[model samples]
Target: MNDSLHTVSLIKIALYSAFAFVLSVITVVFITPFFPESAHDFLRFLAEVGIVLAVSLFIVRHLNKKDVSLRSIVGDTSVSKKMLLFSSSLTIGKLILYFLFAGLVLRFFITQPEFAADAQSVMEDTSPPEFNRWLIISTVVLAPVIEEFIFRGIILNKWAEKSSNTRALIISSLLFGLLHIGSFIIPQFIGGLLYGIVYIKTKKLIYPILMHVLNNLIPVGIMLIPAPESTEAFSVSQLIAELTPVLNVVSLVFIIALPVFLFIVYRYSRNLNDEVAPFKFNTRKAI
Candidate 1:
């Protein structure tokens, strides 16, 4: 594409993303109140997903002069055994680090009474069972795909055109972190930063998608596991105190295995790069 055309495409993508974000915020703030809390929450989640997908598809199609499909984003290459191994290794590594940070570090430092109050205020509403199901789906599936497409696929790609890969990664990562503002902001920011690193290392949206899916799935998976019931709400300190012994053991094991997992990811990513190079070269030539 010509410089003028590329510039125009970049602008359009930015505008569309901005519009989608604004629309999502508005829907959450305003439209949610008109319906029952649970139904409203569910609808809002769906609306956000729909808006993002629609906007992204529309902008990419108009700018690139081609249809934007999942296949396009995921690429046409077969998932080789090596790629699977790498993805799995990287995913496991990420989960371990995430748990260390979220379950241990953040949980320890950010456990002030004010922080707990703020967190409670944000989660004030009692979402219905159906809403909870939709929330889970949105978080675990739709969110990971759509967000990776926008942040890594579009934003990072665009920035990489005009800057070094490292610079692009940092900028995109910061934007990703900033985008997570509100309740749960700290953990979200840390998650974004970690995903950014994964994106930089793998140079594929899939790495971050896997990381994201695992991040969301871990909590959802925990919720699925049966636990002893208690009538009273558990304080942050109480929960931490209860889990400290188990968390310590898990952390030690993860720390020991992390380096090996990182090495596997590095090798896997290299293989993926080798496989993708020829396709990228051909695509460039065709363009």
Candidate 2:
């Protein structure tokens, strides 16, 4: 378990992710065609879960080959109720920041008819009820668990062993953000960083996973709000106008609450650390 041989390289991480994605795609393609359209969503979900579980096991076994225990990677620290509460409050602040920034981008797009058309198209694409249902399950449920395990539970700890915690935080967050690609890059990246910090401070994989689920809940809740059944074409200004007031109020509240939440979390984290040292993986140990 020499440091030289302990690294989880970026290429390996990319390959692992791509392998899961490609395997899921292949499974869906091979299996879904035989099922009735009514059953496709459920079947697809099963396929995704199956593939992810299989890949996760494979990754764990691979790590075990190098003497890294899954328990160590996931950490041994106990999480407290107050810590979870403060962390969740901080996550709300992050979500508000996202919505405010999204509002700004929408406002900018309001000035450009061409961009508005593209935005309209994207909205239409996602408006399907079936798509929204699947998106909710995927985003709010599966993604937090799977992505947190891969990025924070595994990648961050291994990379910290190979390099340093700071570098591990930056690189893992960067990879997480890049996974979203396109316009989601910045927000997802920042979210990754926040989750990474929580993982480091709490030394518990469940904290970040729970926080990630909470962060996604707000957006999915908004998406689930029933829109008027209008046959009329989309209007960017109308959309912005309807959303602006709520976003502004929330953003203002977030601005005021964020610092308080940070202070509480910081204080609690310090107490937790004093009680039990934040677990670092034993990369130097061999079975």
Candidate 3:
């Protein structure tokens, strides 16, 4: 019956996700036709920024009015060596996990025709360099901040009030995936789950944001690399081997260490601050 959990039921989660999705789709359907083809990407990006920001901020503000406070989610925590290692390891693990799964999908499931079309779709990013630059900045910087604030800082924290950390993490992570609602759903769902766990463990918004930024930047960096058509023939394994043996070694290390790191993080997260009093801001309403 706590206030934080009151506004954040499974029903509310579904409803919020539906609202955001419908609104985004409606906005796109109505607005995109009016824009000239040349400026569509830029305009769509702008619309997305405005809509997602407005919607998320409004929802977060209303949720914060309940038992969940910004202070609790933002919990005065500083970056440390442990946090850095944890974030780095988790990010690396996520990359390896995603690629490994993608490799399997590409290897066994997607037919030659599908692969050819996929490669074409991937290669056809004919956007100007300037547009690519803006896209990178928006995804790498803005996405982390906005997404972490809403999914972790607001929704996850609120759910945690009356549920186990595991339940809250699952709910928030799924909600995060729901927001993507396309080809992004699977990877984002995995990333969201890991980020949720990181947020719960670190008890800080910055760590998840940092992890998200780093995760996103990896793909952008890869995209900036020149990929010739010849390379398209390489399977994921061949590609990995050809790219760098060192990366495989690193991935192996992360795969082995993922469980150990998760255990350590879980242990650290379970330690309550019973001895030290909870942080208090100026007003009772704030906490």
**Taking the candidates one at a time, how many backbone clashes does each contain?**
0, 0, 0
The sequence of per-residue lDDT tens digits that candidate 3 reaches over residues 1-287 is 13244564446644765687578768877888997877767766776676567666666656556645556556655799887887877887678666654544444434455655565565566554443565677789878887887787766765666565677778888888888897468778778877877666556677888899999999788878774445345454454344355445545665576687567556755643221112122123343
Model 3 stretches with alpha carbons more than 4 Å out = 1-35, 60-68, 104-133, 184-186, 228-287
Q: Which candidate is the best by TM-score?
A: 2
Tell me the TM-score of each prediction against the true structure: 0.65, 0.74, 0.65
Question: Which stretches of candidate 1 lie above 4 Å from their native place?
Answer: 1-12, 24-34, 65-74, 102-131, 182-207, 230-251, 254-282, 285-287
Ranking by lDDT: 2, 3, 1
**Best-fitting candidate, scored by lDDT:** 2
On the 0 to 100 scale, the lDDT of residue 224 in model 2 is 72
lDDT of 3 at 224: 85
Candidate 2, 27-121: lDDT as tens digits = 88998889898888887777677766776777766765665566665664477999788679778877766666566665555566686677677
lDDT of 1 at 278: 20
- Give lDDT: candidate 3, residue 148: 84
Q: Residue 35 deviation, candidate 3, in Å?
A: 4.7
**Model 3 compared with the native: what TM-score?**
0.65
lDDT of 1 by residue, 199-233 (tens): 55544567678778887788788777765555687
Better of 2 and 3 by TM-score: 2
